[model samples]
Each structure stands twice: as C-alpha cells, then as structure tokens.
Target chain A: MTNLPLSVPVAPNRLSLSKFARRSPSAAIGAALVVLILLVALFAPWIAPYDPIAQDIANRLMPPSAAHWFGTDSFGRDLLSRLIYGTRPTLMLLAIVILLTTPVGIAIGIVAGFYGGMVERILMRITDIAMAFPKLVLALAFVAVLGAGLVNGALALALTAWPAYARQTRSETVSLRKSDYLAAAEMMGITGPRLLFGHVLPLVLPGAIVRMALDLGGIILIAAGLGFLGLGVRPPTPEWGAMVADGTQVIFDQWWVAATPGAAILLTSFAFNLLSDGLRDLMDPRNG
Target chain B: MSLVDISDLNVTFRDQDVGRHILRGITVAIEEGETFGLLGPSGCGKSTLLRVIAGLNRDWHGSMSLLGEAVAPRRRFTGKLRRQVQMVFQDPYASLHPRHRIGRALREPLVVNGLDNPDKRVTEALAEVGFGPDVASRYPHQLSGGQRQRIAIARALLLRPKLLLLDEPTSALDMSVQAEILNLLVTLKARFGMSFVLVSHDPDVIGHMCDRAARMAEGRIAATFDRPALAAGAAAAR
Candidate 1:
C-alpha cells in the first residue's frame, strides 16, 4: 500500500554557484563586488600606489592625473590609497558589530521565547525600551559616554543593534516553540540548553543571517556617520567618513575628494542590500 | 503495575481572561505490552491525553503513574521515566526536524541520553525501518510521506521506549500509505514488545490494531470496548 506518490526525485542539497548566479544575478553581482572590496581591503598596503599618510605639499590639491589617480587630499596624500585603507576600519566595525550583536540577540530571544513567563516579560520589555529609542541617538549617547574610537563606536552601534535581532528572533522562536518538531524534542527529554541551542538555534539562524546581511548596509552608514561626527577612529587613519569630512572643506573647488569616499560607502552599502535581497529569496521556502 | 495509569486528569488552558478545559477527568490504565486505543472524534482531548502521558503537557492536574512510578504535575520526566516513553506525532512532515539528517535525528536521543554506540544504533534503526544506510544522509523533505513517517517511527524506537504513544500517526497520510505505516507500527510493536496507546478517529484502525479500545467524546471517555465489540463496531462502520 505505498500509494502516495512513491518517492519524488530528490533535489541536490547544495546549490551550485552557476545555478545561484542564474537564479539571482543581482546577488551574484553583489557578492562579486563585496569580494572585490574585501580583496582591496586585504591588500591595501601593497596595492596602494603611495603611502596614504605621507604628504607631498607640492602636489597638494592635484586633480586626477597619470601621476595621481583619484587626485590628492589637502595634505597631498594619495586619495586612492586613503580610500583603500579606509575599507579596513569599515569592514572591521562591520565584523565587530555583527559578532557582538547576533549571539547576544539570539540567546536572549531564544531564552525568552522558549521559557515564556516572567522571563519573557522582562526580556521583551527591555527589547521594547531599547527599540523605542532612535538607534542613532542611542549610539550617539553610548559613544559620548564611552568616548570616541573604533572599538567604542562599534560598541555603541552594537548596543543599539542587538534589540532588532532580538525582536526578530523572538518572534520566529515563539512560532517555532509551538511546532511539532519541538514538541517531539521535548518528549525526547531534550530540555534546557540542549533544546535551545541544538533544536531552536539551527532553525532560527537562517532568518538571523538574512537579517544580518540586510542590516549590514545600515551598519556601514551608521559607522560612517559616527566617523563624520568626529566620534570614530582618530584622524590620519583614512576612514571614509573622516575623509568625506576632510573633503567637505574644499568641496566647491575639488569635489572628487568627498565624492570618492562617498562613492565607496554607497557601493559597499548597495552590495550588501543586493546580497541580502538575494539571500532572502534563496532562503524563502516558497522559492525552494 | 500498569505501564501507564492516569486518573482524574484535568487539563485547563488559560488565555488571558478565558479558561478552556481541554481534558476533563480522564482516567485510563494501559497494561504492559497491551495495545490500547483511544477512539474519538476531533476536539475530544485524545491527543491531549496522549501528550500528558508523554510528559509534553505538564500543566494538567492529575495522578499519573508510568512503570509503577508516580509522576508529579509540572515536573519534567527524567532518567528512566523519560527513556521509557516516546511519542509519534500526527504530522510526519512536521514531527521530524527539517534541517536535521535522518542519521543525526535518530542518533540524537542516544547521544542526549549518553548511550554508547550511537552509530550502531542508528544503523540498526534505519534497517529496522526498512531504510538503507544511504537514507541516513537524507533530510526530511527529501523523503516521501511514508518514508518520513517510517523515519519518525525509527527515531522514536531508537530509545527502545516501553510505552509508545501514537497521536493520529497516519491521519495525515494517504489511505495506502496509512495502512503501510499502521502495519509498520504493528510489526515494530511486536518486535520491540512495547505497549501502545493509539489515538485515532477511525474505528477500523482501532479494531485492526488495538487489543482494547475506548470511545471518547468532548473530553470524556463515553464508552469502552472489548476486542469483539471493537471488531463488531469496525465491521459495522465498514
């Protein structure tokens, strides 16, 4: 009595790159762009034609030419070199913010959802309070309190970032908590941390990762905002936001300085947005 | 001592200001190695009763004993009590973790219980469920409905549970696949020498599998049936 459509042909578990590219070309292009940026950041020192900090006053404000591509800053430092070096801090802040936020958010969310009672009330209230505040304002407050630097700016962003993830994951976990698979797990005596980490975490991770990717563009903007506000990494580090700040003074005469770093920021943000959209499509069960 | 003895079981769910009673004063005893069936229509607390026995519904007020040990309300099943009880859920597609491979899903109980030879047990489970070792690497979605149900059964049986609770286990399946799964359960029950508390709306299923049966309605056991009565009822329904 094996009636019900006996064994539908199984699809391969892994998605081939060619198939992914074909399915979501925008994501593919985004991925390629992001990879290129990473490579540029990774090899900044070697790839940059001149010392980013070494100023040549004679060539000051020289526009884009054979001798200097992307022209020179007020200090006559290579704009190309500065832009390349700027990628390091931007990428690092992104890494730090994600690393700090995701686990903390996921843990709080899971614990609250799985154990729903006073625990859920307290955790969700805290999340609500955190979310109620404007994220930029909260980050600004945190940076002001902690003092300005790369780690401090990242910390400030991290403090404001986790609540979104917590709320997202909490909602997901709440629904998953009522799922039959979880009920089956409870029957198997897999309670407490094992159930939370093993059963719940894996199921919730795709949503979290997609959210993280989507949030990356916002994170880059916020980090740049912090840098522009004079609360980011110290000057002469060639941060994109700080360079933009530097370029604003001579923007009327030599607009390339501000525009170059501004373009880099925009491209990075666009890449993340495209990648997140592609990932969302890829992870959607309907698409599958 | 009975394998499962429950008396005066009352399960109430409070939703804000409303209190809904799901199972009211359920009393039943399942003997060792006996296949007892709870036959009922939808909304009759049969599945809730099953969940109570499996320790998934801890909010019930009742006296329950499994394997001669009294179980407390709001307390988790642990050690021997936990290992001896397992449940096959209604939906095969929803019961098994979609992300987990068959081998890992089957082996998890063994690993969590700190049992030895998980790989060996997992292999044996696959074989017992009529699956090849290659099936171990497959995800739940890759399998047919019957195949997934078999895997769910395999996962439940890996612990060698003495009392296996089935909550409309084949209700989600097609007629033919349902029969296949029902027969698989019968064979597995015999092989493992385990007691079963089967819940189903079908009298045919109740008569075919259960040694004794109870007809329940609106959270109450309205009638109990002996084997002959069950058979007669099933025949009449047919």
Candidate 2:
C-alpha cells in the first residue's frame, strides 16, 4: 500500500471567521479615514486654492476668516495650504525610508538567525547595543554627523529603524529555524539560499509587514521631531515640524499659528497608529 | 543493498541554559522495500537519530551513507543523495507553515530540487497520500490531524525518497485516524517500492507496520525483533 491516496481540505487564511471579523467597522472606518487623509495629501496642489508660501504680511494673524481658512501664520502664509503641501514631501520621505530599511533589516536578521553559532552571537550583541540607546538619540547623532537635509534625516531614520526590525526579525527567524518543513526542505537537497528565501522568508514576512506598518507611524514621528529640532528640512521649508517651530515664537500671541500645524501632525500620525493597532489585533493569534 | 547506513551516531545539544546528550551513539539501517521501526518511549532521541540520518543535525558525531554516498558532519550535503532521503515530522500543525496553501507547500520541495512540474507532482503526491485534487487548493489548518499527516507523508514521498524517516507520524492522531494513515503508508510503500524508518512508541504501529523492530533503551538498541513475537512484548508496553 505504498501509494495510497487521501483527500483533505486546507483551511483558508490561517484564521477563523471570528478572527477575520475582529477587523470591525471601527477598523475599516479608521482605514477609510487614513485613505482620505492620504488622498487629500496626494491632491494638495489641486485642492488648496492659496499658495502655501505666498505670504500676505498685511493679512497675517487674521483669525480664521472666510477667505483665509485656518488663519494666516506670522509670516502671513496660509496655514492650511502649508500643512497640505507639507504632507507630500514627508510622506515621500517615510515611504523611501521604510523601503530601504525593511529589506536590509530582514536580510541581516535572517542571516544572523538561520546561521547560529559565533555569527549569530556577534550580530545579535551589536543589535542589542544599538537598541539600548533611544531611537531618536541615535538618529540625532547620525544626522549631526551626516549633516542636516531631508534626505539625510531619512537616511538617519532608516539607519536607526533597520535595527528595530533586525532585532525583531532575528528573534522571529530563530523560532522559525526549527520548523519541520524547513528541516524537511533542508534534507530534500534544498540549498541554504533556496531554503532561506523560499521557506523561511515567506514565513516571517507577515510579521515583518505588521511590524513595518507600526514603524510607519514611528517614522512620521521621528521625521517631524527632526524637523522640529532644525535637523529636518531647513528653515522656511513647508515641513510640519519646521512650520510648528517657526510659529512657536508668535504662539503666545496667536495660538493657531503654533497649534494648527501641530494639530495636522497629531491627526495624520494618529490615523496610522490606529491602523497599526487594528492590524496588530487582526494578525495576532490571541485576539481571535 | 541498504538504502541508508548509519553507524555510531552521537548527537549533543549545548545551550547557555542547559547542556545534555540527545542521541548516544545510535545506529540503524533500512533496506529497499523494508519498513524498519525505531520503537521507543518518549524523549528517547528517536527524532534526533532520524535527523542525523537526514544530515540536518550537523552537531552530531556520526558515520552515515544514503545510497552509498558518505555524509561528513558539519559539511555540505550531496544534493542527489540528500534528495533521495527525506523525513516526516510528528506534528503537522507545527511542521507546515500557516501562510502557504497546500499547493505551495507541495510545490516548494520540487522547486528546491530544480524540478519544473511541481504542481503536477504535488497533485500526484497528494493523491498518493489519499488526498483528492481539490485538497491542493486548501491550507493546513482546514485539514484534520490525519489529513495533515497524509500531507506530510505526501510531501516526503514527492521526492520519491529511498529511505523515508517517519518520526511518530500517527502518534498525534486518534486510534482510527492512526490506522487509516498506517494503512496509507503501507499501501504507498508496497506500491512505490520505497523503504521506511518509522519511529514510534506505539505497539500496534511497530507490530503492524514494520518488518523488523528495535527497542531503543536510552539511545542504544537493546534488542531487535525480526517477527511478531516481540509484537507480544510491544503489546504489553501499552
């Protein structure tokens, strides 16, 4: 009876109906809100009527008029337009930083994990040391050494960000290395590269993606903080942090000048954080 | 001729927390068309010995050969011979990746060994293990324990391995399901002319499935039974 045949149905999505349903109306609404924000950002040029940089010194601090919605800044720039325009470049920066860090971090983590012994010990120790310092402080040090610019800040953020993913993914890989199919794959004449990419990579990707989504919110915060400290976009640029910092001097007199761009930063990142929370709920096994 | 030859195999595990011996210089063999059982109690290093024969555990000190090619510990494996040897794990839930569909799980092995018709092979393999064509579209979690074990067996058989290492294939299932799978393995073996190295502590499995049985006391083989008389001793075990 060497070649007996059997029939079975494979379960779908590795989750039950109750688990999938955990992505409630509230989560979808959160996602929709995020999509709306991104859409507004994507069409900022078409949507906002006034020029973000076109300063009307005479109309400055006019306090939310019909024509000048969100009031005029100390520089007489339209706060609404600056915020809308400000989103484009920062979003672009976040996307690029994520793209670069994810692969680098995952690769390094996988290598250190799959090939244990001295190599694992050394790489993990370095990652631990890097992780001990705060992420913002590390980015700050790198940006200081690398010099201030939007790209430099993005690069610095990526440098610090890769280690977070590297450490998390390294732990994930360590657990995955012992999985039986991986061992079976190895015994079936599968090369290290083939086993690593085909088997181990696919297994860890969902977790990495979930982590990346969470990191997206963090990236926004870091970039804005850098901009606030003047290590982000140079003075007078339409960055949210730069605008907020520039408006701080006149904040005591005109509160919206400081608070408006600050509000924009809060709301945009809040949407992402909520989305991350939703994803964590969905992907986690315990929630279902 | 022996499909697999293992001699004086000793595997060890050392971590920061604990260091212990796993396989204490165990040896076993499987001839073509034979079902040999490494019948033992729990935590007896049956799986570890199978891993040594499969060339997955490089930390072991051993001499092993699959189809006449020698395996050196802590070195590169010979692809052709390695492909001729495969293993089936005890737990299907832990063995199969949650994300992959049945087809992907089956296709991966064939692809890794440089075969193109992985889907066709997957279908054929699934059929060989009693799964119908439609089962290929599903994932692991949807299947029962017996069904998952069949899939695991199908995956091992896809390569048409000479010596199949079945590490407690049916222990995780109920009695009825275990019988179904054992019948499947027996049917598959006679049909395909393949050999087996079945590791289990179950008396019925050792009695019904294997041509020869070895009781592994600690890690060394204490006795080998050529017929069903030891089947009496095996029955007394439960």
Candidate 3:
C-alpha cells in the first residue's frame, strides 16, 4: 500500500502556507530576508552608496560612521558596500555550481537507478572514485589547477559536490524506478534518456534542492575558506570572506571590522540551511 | 490486422544472487477494439506478461508485435508506434511520478510523441477523466488516490493510443473508486474504440471491465471466460 505512489494526499483543509508556518517562522522570515539581500546584491551597482573597491585612506577605520557606513575597512573600502557586492559572487558561485552539478548528478543517478546494469555500476564506481577524495581536498586541487578565480572556483566546487548529488540521487532514483509510473512510462516506450530526464529528473529535483540547501552553506563556506586562504576572488576585491580574512589582522582593536562581514556570511548561510530544513518538511509529497 | 501478437514469451529473473525463472512461456493476442483480461493470482507472472508486451521488461525471450510489424527488444516503438501503445500501472501512487504535476504527467506522452497543441490535449485529457482545468497545475502528490488514478488515465488518453496495457489498474484503489474508474474505462473504450490488454488479480474487476477474461497460472493461461457470462457476481457490484 505504501508503494502506491498516489494513495495518500494532502488533506483538503491543509494549505501550503499553514504547513510552511508549522515548519518554522524563523525560516520563513530568514528566507525572505536572505532573498531580499540577494536581490539587493544582484542590483548592488545602483543600490550601494559607494563603489566597493574605491579606497579612501582618510575614511579607513572610521568606526561605523554614517558617511562610510559599517565603517571603512583597514584598506579604506566600505565594508557594507563590499559585503553587499560580496553576496552576488558567492551566491552566484553557489548557484552556478549547484546548477552545473545538480542536473548532471541527477541525470546520472536516474539512469543508474532506472537502468540497473553496467551503466549503474560504472556510474556508481566513477562517482565513488570521485567521492573517495575529500571534497575540499579535490576543490583545492581544482583551484590549484584552474588557478584561483571565481568561475574556476565554481568549477572546483561543482566537480566535488556533484558526487554527493549523484549518490543521493542514485539511491532515491533506484527506489523510484521500482514505482509503477516509471515502469508505466517505459511501458509506453518512454525508456532510456527520455524517461530518465523527463520523468525521474523532476522527481529527484526535490532531493537536489535539499542537497543544494546543504550545499549552499558549504559552497559559501568553501568560497570563504578559499578567500580566507587567498585563493578566492583576488585581493582588494570586495569579497565578504576575504574582507573577514583582512579584518582578522586587526581583530584585537577593531573587533567590529572582522566580526561584521563574518556575521553576515554566517547569517546568510544559516538562513539557507534552515530554509532547506523547512523546505524538506514542506516539500514532502506525503505531506501534500 | 491484429493489434497485438505475442509468441514464445518468457521472462526470467535473478534471485539477487541466483538467476531464476519468473515467467515460463506466455502467449496471447487481441484484435482491434477488443478487451483482453489476463486474470491470475499474485506472483503468477501476469504482470511479467504485461511488461513483456509493453516493452519494459528486457530479461525475456519473446516475440511481440503491434499491427503486423515485428518488434525488436531493443528497438522501442517511436513516433507513431509509440503513440499507438500506452500503459496504466497497478498502483495509482507509484504509477504517476510524484514530482510531476498532473499537467506534466498528462502531457508527457503528447510531448514524447511530438504531438502539436499539447496544452489543448492536456486540457481535453483532464476533462475526459472527470477532472477540471485546475487539476492540471497540481503535482501528483497533491491529488487524491482516486484523483491521481484519474490523472494517470488522463495521461494514457493524451497519447491517443490504439492499444493500452493495464496492470491491475484498480487493485490499489477503494472499491468505490475502482467502480468509478472502471466505468470511466468502459465509456472511454466505447467512445474511442481502443483495444485493451489488462492484467489483474481480481477476477471480479476483470469480469466487470473486460470483454474476455483469461485465467493465468504459472505464467500460462489456465482458463478463459467471455465477459458477458461472468456477470452473475460482478453485475450486482456494478
């Protein structure tokens, strides 16, 4: 009876908003705020008060003054504007990596699950081999190979992150392939890549979304980690991670200098993590 | 020409560690607009028989054809051939991909078949299945079992298929829902002149919807009864 995919459904009285509210008020608020922040980041050029990169030594370390709000960094750049502009590249990389890896991973997983044969073994083995290496270690290797830049960093993130998406997708797909609809699609001559992409891909997207939830935080952390290590969006660049990295040099006297960008990164990533959890509950098909 | 022809059909499976024979030899056929029931108890290879004919199960040795053309196990029916054949799965839940909205599921066959005006076909399919325009936008998980089964039916209809292979289409549904679906199938056939080859464990359901019912055991048909004669019990239920 449980294998019956369509048996249980959302009770007519249950609204999606109510279920979302039941899940987490903090997540809803945080998700909204984060989305707005991203929107602001996406339009930073018009929204930001000053160019994030322009240096003003006189304004440097101004300590939260209104003219150079959030205060100027030691390098005389606006921390708030830099942080605002910083959100875009990190979010962009996070989105780009997930976009690159998620579909490919999902495709591989669905095919392996749907057509459990040599293809499954090969794909799993390949994913396993890739996964065996520590993701960060692989990212480091890729960063080294691609030579420290934004798109390259995103590519590095994609290479390692894809394996997890593949593994998760494969297991989910294997279970789903046993479902009658998948077989029905095949029975209708909708087998091979068509069934994998058309049918199973949609099913796995939720799982991919869940993974992206988890990955978003990790990607930000990784980008920040790389930026902190001086491999991210190049120095004097308005990267939040790199900003925090630069701030730590003056942490004892200027606690706000280091703490502000760090807190921003922490809060934005935390919001995505919580939102992922809320989405997991809300998106459960049985819940609907 | 006969709409379906199967000869020397055999399906085998491995017991995880050891390969085992799941289906012996099953052979059956149906002409255009005819309803053929494959009735059997659970684990009697009835589903395997249907899958073989539907081109889903490859671990088989059989010759199956549609409309006088020979079918290659690997050569899936494409274009017109694909549109000519369709299937409704056993479990209403598992048969419809959960992530797909009702519209995508309904429009899938149309898209795969390269049909023009998929939107119109999707709307028509929903309406034909007793669903409204709103149902199309909702995901599979959003619909009730009866409602989901209706969508599955709507999906099958969107292809404008000449033949349909149904595997216990209503076994997972409540009796009331089953009756409603059965009635829908009956009327659709009458309206479209589509042939059916249905596999079911429920003899009563088979008798109610199919024009002919063949009992299968051990992967082979044991007895067959014409649809009109079995009305003694099924008629009262109907």
**Top model by lDDT, which number?**
1
Residue A144 error for model 1, in Å? Answer: 3.4
Better of 1 and 2 by TM-score: 1
Interface RMSD of 2: 3.5
Best-performing candidate as measured by TM-score: 1
lDDT of each: 0.89, 0.78, 0.78
Candidate 2 — which residues are off by over 4 angstroms?
Answer: A1-22, A125-147, A285-288, B15-19, B231-238
Find the 10 residues in a row with the least total lDDT in model 3 chain A: A1-10
Cα lDDT for residue A165, candidate 3: 83
1 versus 3: better TM-score goes to? 1
Clashing pairs in 3: A4-B93, A5-B93, A5-B94, A6-B93, A10-A288, A181-B95
Give the runs in model 1 whose Cα sits over 4 Å from its true position: A1-8, A285-288, B234-238
Residue lDDT tens for model 3, B1-238: 5788877777778778886677766667777888888877788888887776676765677787887777877665566776767888878878887677777777766676678998988877777877667667777766777887878887877777788888888888998888888888888887888999988777677766777767877777777776566565442232
Best DockQ goes to which candidate? 2
RMSD of 3: 5.3
**For residues A31-111, what per-residue lDDT tens digits would candidate 1 score against the true structure?**
999999999999999999999999999999889999899999999999999999999999999999999999999999999
State fnat for each of the candidate structures.
0.62, 0.71, 0.57
Q: List the residue pairs that clash in candidate 1.
A: none
Looking at model 2 chain A, report the run of 10 residues with the lowest lDDT sum.
Answer: A1-10
The true-versus-predicted C-alpha distance at residue B86 of model 2, in Å, is: 1.3
